[model samples]
Target chain A: DVKVTQSSRYLVKRTGEKVFLECVQDMDHENMFWYRQDPGLGLRLIYFSYDVKMKEKGDIPEGYSVSREKKERFSLILESASTNQTSMYLCASTQIGTGRTEAFFGQGTRLTVV
Target chain B: AQRVTQPEKLLSVFKGAPVELKCNYSYSGSPELFWYVQYSRQRLQLLLRHISRESIKGFTADLNKGETSFHLKKPFAQEEDSAMYYCAHHPTQGGSEKLVFGKGTKLTVNP
Candidate 1:
């Protein structure tokens, strides 16, 4: 079965500390995305990559960055964690040439920045 | 800019009752809409897409371009239907690969 795996299901980080959330997809999809889910704001896109070594900022890319060195891996980096950054982070993957736009999501990582 | 709005934060219904989850979007170009569901402890997954025009688990959604809405409807609500439903869209432009999601609506079907 196809899967998107996130390294951590739950994480806690201190304020001002750097953090990394790793995601790997076995589907070999060309598109990978990172989104943050909040109570009232829904899922907001943070960043996405359509190709290896290429990335683009999404609607909310303020305090986050992403790295995609390989096709199957996409890493979200929080340079300096803040209390407001505590939210559920999700990773998704989709194929480019499939003529479909459905995204398969990971189990999500619930991050708490203290 | 493209945007999706799900006004109701929560919708509650009893078993066997008909349920409709409202979703509205704003995008000038052609739009592809989708409904996603996330049950407790499960990852979010695609429930249905407008283009497919097919029903899954007895749920259906119709894209009303005239009203700029895509509402998910089910004839009978089951207790197992309790979950979070998200309305998403992908515009013809840069949004084709990335889905823009709205604030999800939590559905509760009491048995």
Candidate 2:
């Protein structure tokens, strides 16, 4: 079975602290994405990487950054955690294709900035 | 700008009733659409895609270019069908492979 593993299911951090959410996929997908899921806003893309060391900003890339030093792992970073940054973060991976492929998602990390 | 819209924020229906979740998009060219479902305490998963045209778990979606809509429908909704559904659009022409998602609709199938 294909698996996308997130480092944490839940995390709590203090304001102004740095936070890291890690995601690893066993499918050897070339494309990985990070999204923040909110109640009314749904899933807003924060960042995505198509290849190792190549990153692209998404619609809501502010206050967040991503690192893809390796193929199977991608990490989301919060430089300064704030209360407004608290949300459910999801990581997904998909094979490189002509855009007809499905994305497999991880179990999500629910972060709380207190 | 490419955008996907899901008008309904929440939908409720009793078991064995027909259900339809609306999804609309605005893009320049032919769009690639997908429906993703997230069950309670589960990861988000691909429910169906427009290109496949295959029924999944008794659910089907038909793309209408005239109206620019791809609505997910099921003749009979079961209690297990209650979940959060998101509509996404993938840009095939652009070099970017990112997906644009809607605000999502939470379906509640009461027994």
Candidate 3:
């Protein structure tokens, strides 16, 4: 069984605070992604890293950033959190491939901003 | 642009009743489609895909290129089927690993 571990299950942060959510996949997948899931908006991508030190911005990447120092670890950083930025954060990983491949996901981190 | 669409936000049906969850897509190029389910208190997982033409847990989905749709179906619904179902797309950009997901449809199966 593949394991994608998230650093936190639930987190509380104040407005304008800095927050960091971590994800580590045991499979050493080359592709890692960060997504923010909201009720009606679905899962919007924040950022993704296909290789160490490489990052690409997603549709909703204005308030977020990501770090990939190693193959298995990907970190999502909120430079300055806001109430609107609070959401259920999901991390996923997949082996780099040209053909169809399934992504494995972590349990998710539900962040609350007050 | 590549996109996935799940028109219904919720669907309710009785156990043993036939169930269908609709999914549509708009992609300029040939794309792959996927149906993902997230059961209550459980992580989201892949339920089926159009490419493999396989049924999972009695559920199956078909890709209609002319209509640009991939709809999920089950001959009989079950209470354990209640969950958030997300339709996803992998654009013909081919190597794009980031999948564009739909808003999701919440299925509730009654006893």
lDDT of each: 0.92, 0.94, 0.88
Task: Compose the digit string of candidate 2's lDDT tens values, residues B41-70.
Answer: 999999999999999999999999999999
lDDT of 1 by residue, B17-109 (tens): 999999999976567788999999999999999999999999999988899999999999999999999998865554346668999999999
lDDT of 1: 0.92
TM-score of chain B of each: 0.94, 0.97, 0.93
Q: Classify candidate 1 by CAPRI docking class.
A: medium
For each prediction, how big is the interface RMSD? 2.2, 1.2, 1.8
Considering summed lDDT, which 10 consecutive residues are worst modelled in model 2 chain A?
A94-103
Clashing pairs in 1: none
Docking class of 2: medium
Model 3: pairs clashing at backbone N, Cα or C within 3 Å: none
Per-residue alpha-carbon lDDT of candidate 2 for residues A1-114, written as tens digits (9 for 90 to 100): 749999999999999999999999998899999999999899999999999999999998989989999999999999999999999999999888637988899999999999
Error of 2 at B67 (Å): 0.4
Instruction: Give the proportion of true interface contacts each model preserves, from 0 to 1.
Output: 0.60, 0.73, 0.42
The single-chain TM-score for chain B of candidate 3 is: 0.93
Mark the regions of model 3 whose C-alpha exceeds 4 Å error after superposition.
B92-95
